[model samples]
Target: MAYRGRFAPSPSGPLHAGSLVAALASWLDARAHGGAWLVRIEDVDRPRNVPGADEEILRQLAACGLVPDRPPTWQSQREALYQAALDRLVREGKAYPCACSRRDIALALFAQGRERTRHGELVYPGTCRAGLHGQEARAWRLRVPEGVVPWTDRRVGVHLQNVAEEVGDFVLKRADGLFAYQLAVVVDDADQGITHVVRGEDLVDNTPRQILLQRALGVPTPQYLHAPLVLGPNGEKLSKQNGAAAVEVAQPAAALAAAARVLGITVDPRVAVPELLAQAVRAWGARYP
Candidate 1:
């Protein structure tokens, strides 16, 4: 596999502090392992994508001296790949169409005397697992198997989850005719030969579902390292939705140093961007090796 790693970011906004932490961590991991570092624009959710956000994200990465080894991929242009993967799942009976909407799922859960999970995610009741029952199909969902799926995180250590019991049969294709993140990410990782994934801890919950998708699609699961999240002033995960400001790359070294601090790798912010990143790579190797 040659230790390939990637930093995939959605094109919803420019690189913010939290996103830079993820980007820096992934770049560090790739450099530390002497691997190829790649980038991918996760713009499959067309509605959320800003018109020029992808270009701005690349410019931001370049300013921080975290350029990819190859030209970045855009999920929006790869619908055929996702469709092919979904088709295989459908043929294998691992996926099926669902007619349930948000309200339908809520009502089904209520009937079963169940409430949303602690994370506030509504667990689907598999209402259309048998068939759509003549109702028009609204989306496609994977038929998650029963039993705990155990996986290890390089940073967070061991974790276990029963996808069937917890997440239920999650969507592969959404009602809006867009491919779900779970499916697009799995397919992209496999297609890109990504051997490692380094991102924020906020996405750690998504790992199990992605693992399940990898198994269903018969693709290799990459090693994961979830970096600590950078918090906002309100002590919440920093995000564009919460008005987290974009990284000011006018001073590249300072920006890179701030992100490195989140990864527990302190470096001289006064140095040039190249030297600062070099120091970061060494520190990261020592800790993560």
Candidate 2:
């Protein structure tokens, strides 16, 4: 397959320094391989989305000379595709409806002498795998298989996760009548023909669930390269929820150069955005190749 990569950003807020790092890394990866780079607005989580945030994100990227090769895609507008995928999974017996609320899951895990993972997520106890009993369905979950799921990351090398043990049957569709990120992202990447995924290290844990979804949906899995995360002053991952400020795109070259440094690339910040990106791309190709 041809090299095709994407930078999918949620519209919860404008692009910050941390988000810029991800965007720049994905753009450089695509350009380094002489591939097409695309953008997708991950606004599927409706409640968190800020009005006009998507437009502002696009503006930030444009100011930094990281334009997508094609018109950007919006996840909110692709409900039909996600519904079709969920329906197929339900039909194949690879997915089932669950009536377990967060409390129900906690109680069940407690009864089974199990505790939440270090990440504070309860490894769901498959309470509804057999049947929902008399309970009404509130969500849909994939029936993850046993054994280790092994995959290689371009930057991080090998990794293995047993989804059945670690994550259990994760949600495909949430109780709020929205498709989960794992499901929507998998479907979109397959639909968009994304052959490569370059994002921040924080999302590395999500790769296993996405890989499981791709297999269940019979779609091709993309190569992954998780760029280093940009940390806040408090030493935590910089994020919108953590009050990371929006990047100043007025000085696009400086913004891009700062983000490039996080990825271990040095470029002349005095140059224009286009020239700075060109220099970064050459440096990226040398490093990533």
The segments of candidate 1 whose C-alpha lies over 4 angstroms from its true place after superposition are none
lDDT of candidate 1 over 1-289, digit per residue (tens):
7999999999999999999999999999999999999999999999999889999999999999999999999998999999999999999999999999989999999999987763777899999999988999999999999999999999989999988888899999999999999999999999999999999999988999999999999999999999999999999999999998989989888888889998999999998888999999999999999
Q: In model 2, which regions exceed 4 Å deviation? A: none
Tens-place lDDT digits, model 2, residues 16-100:
9999999999999999999999999999999999999999999999989999999999999998999999999999999999999
Where does candidate 2 clash, by residue pair? none
Quote the positional error of residue 72 for candidate 2 in Å. Answer: 0.7
TM-score per candidate, in order?
0.99, 0.99
Relative to the true structure, how large is the alpha-carbon lDDT of every model? 0.94, 0.95
Residue 101, candidate 1: C-alpha displacement in angstroms: 0.4
Q: What TM-score would you give candidate 1 relative to the actual structure?
A: 0.99
* Candidate 2, residue 90: how far the Cα is off, in Å: 0.6
